[model samples]
Target: MTVRSDDTTLEITRVFDAPPARVFAAWLDLGQFQSWIGPEGIDCEVELLEPRVGGRYRLVMNTPERVIPVSGVFRSIEPCRRLVFTWGWEGDAIRQSLITLTFREIGGKTELTLRQEGLGSVESRDGHVRGWNSALNKLDHYLSGGARR
Candidate 1:
């Protein structure tokens, strides 16, 4: 996406204890999503949120010596089944990526799948894969009542 002409894709899968509706709600709610948007050590703060399609959302991830800004516009919202949004990391994700998240119910548990596309290079793709894995793992713990301190 960035200024580059090429595009890449990244995908990851994880399971959450909650139901699809609940998980979707967490994503839809600014406060809840902020509580679990980043890696274990990174703190997230919500700035602006509009969850419907064609809406905008913004958040900041604070870490050592840096504040990462993330902004997105929702492209699709399918209740408990799917969500599609454009993701930009203030200065980085600008490389161009549209992220899609799909939630499915399996035996009362929710399976979450993240698909990111339109990245321009391998480095950006790798960074997103790592970032998504960390975020999703943190979310898994959060949903399981980790009592994170």
Candidate 2:
């Protein structure tokens, strides 16, 4: 995994030992998403999921201390290629950000790139880097047939 970040944006690239279609399907599949979409050791709940453009979704991550609720609307979806969405914490609408994910096929594997912007501060961007890296690691493990959380 590689992560790059500036003052208000973050980019991550990772390679997964799965095809692009399977990798892309993970994001739209509520069951698969909840299994690997949070930091390691965190539990996730899918409150709502609508994978089409203009559709809304909600997820809750349960940490040891508290539950963090996140909500989003799908902006675009291109099967096996790309996805774009708006992301924000449930009660913090003003801090909404945009996330774009692109998947490319390489030698039967998937190269996934994620770009996120509109963070309120550098601290927020850094925090997302950590969270996303952990989440991606979990996703890789899941794709490799590891036990689900």
Candidate 3:
């Protein structure tokens, strides 16, 4: 996996051994999503998940320091291909961002590209870089049939 960040945006690219459909399903399926969507050692709870466009979802991430609630609305969804969503913290609704995921099939594997924009600051973008990289590492392990934490 490779992660890159700029002033207000972050991009991550990862190759998974699973097929595109399986990899894409992991993002929308609550059971699958909760298994691999947060930084290492963080416990995640999916409060609500509505996978269709215009639908909303909420998640609570319990880190060692504190619990963070994140909510989002699905903007677009194309099965096994792409997904776009609006992301924001529950308390700070004004600081909303956009996340786009693209899935491409290569041989029998899948190439996943994640792009998050409008982070508002370099520090925030960097934080996401670390968080996302760690999350993707977990995703890789999960797809490899490793036990979920």
Candidate 4:
């Protein structure tokens, strides 16, 4: 995995031991997505998911001490190739961001690149870096047969 960030944007790249279609499905399928979306020890509940362009999704991440709700609108979807979406915390309008994900097939595996922009600050971008990395690690484990349900 690799990460790059600036004050307003962050990018992370990870290679998964699965095909592009499989990896992409994990994001679009609600049950699959709920299985590996949050950091370790956090449980994610997907409230709504509509996989097409202009669709909307909402999910809540539950930790022992907090409930974090996030919602987004799908801006683009390209099957196993790419996705673009608008993301925001439930009550925070000023911190809205745009996220783009691109998947590349490499030797039967998938390389996923995630880019989030309009973060508003370096601190916010850094927090997302940690959150996304942890989530992606779970995704890796899930795809590798460790956390698959």
TM-score of every model?
Answer: 0.88, 0.97, 0.96, 0.96
What would the TM-score be for candidate 1 when compared with the true structure? 0.88
Q: Regarding lDDT, does 1 or 3 come out ahead?
A: 3
Q: After superposition, how far is residue 9 of candidate 4 from its true place, in Å?
A: 0.4
Clashes of each: 4, 0, 0, 0
Compose the digit string of candidate 4's lDDT tens values, residues 1-149: 88988889999999998999999999999988988987877888899999999999999998889899999999999999999999899899998999999999999999999999999988899889999999998999898878542
> Which digits, one per residue and each the tens of the lDDT, describe model 3 over residues 8-62?
9999999999999999999999899888888898898889999999999999999
Off by over 4 Å in 3: none
Task: Report lDDT (Cα) of residue 76, candidate 4.
Answer: 95
**How many angstroms is residue 82 displaced in model 2 relative to the true structure, after the best TM-score fit?**
0.4
Clashing pairs in 1: 1-95, 1-96, 2-95, 2-96
RMSD of each: 4.6, 0.8, 0.9, 1.2
Give the per-residue Cα lDDT of candidate 1 at 67: 91
Best to worst by lDDT, what's the order? 2, 4, 3, 1
lDDT per residue for candidate 2 within 30-87, as digits (tens), equals 8898878888888888889899999999999988899899999999999999999999
Error of 1 at 110 (Å): 1.0
Superposed Cα deviation of residue 33, candidate 4 (Å): 0.5
Global fold similarity of model 4 (TM-score): 0.96
User: Model 1 off-target regions past 4 Å?
Assistant: 1-7, 91-94
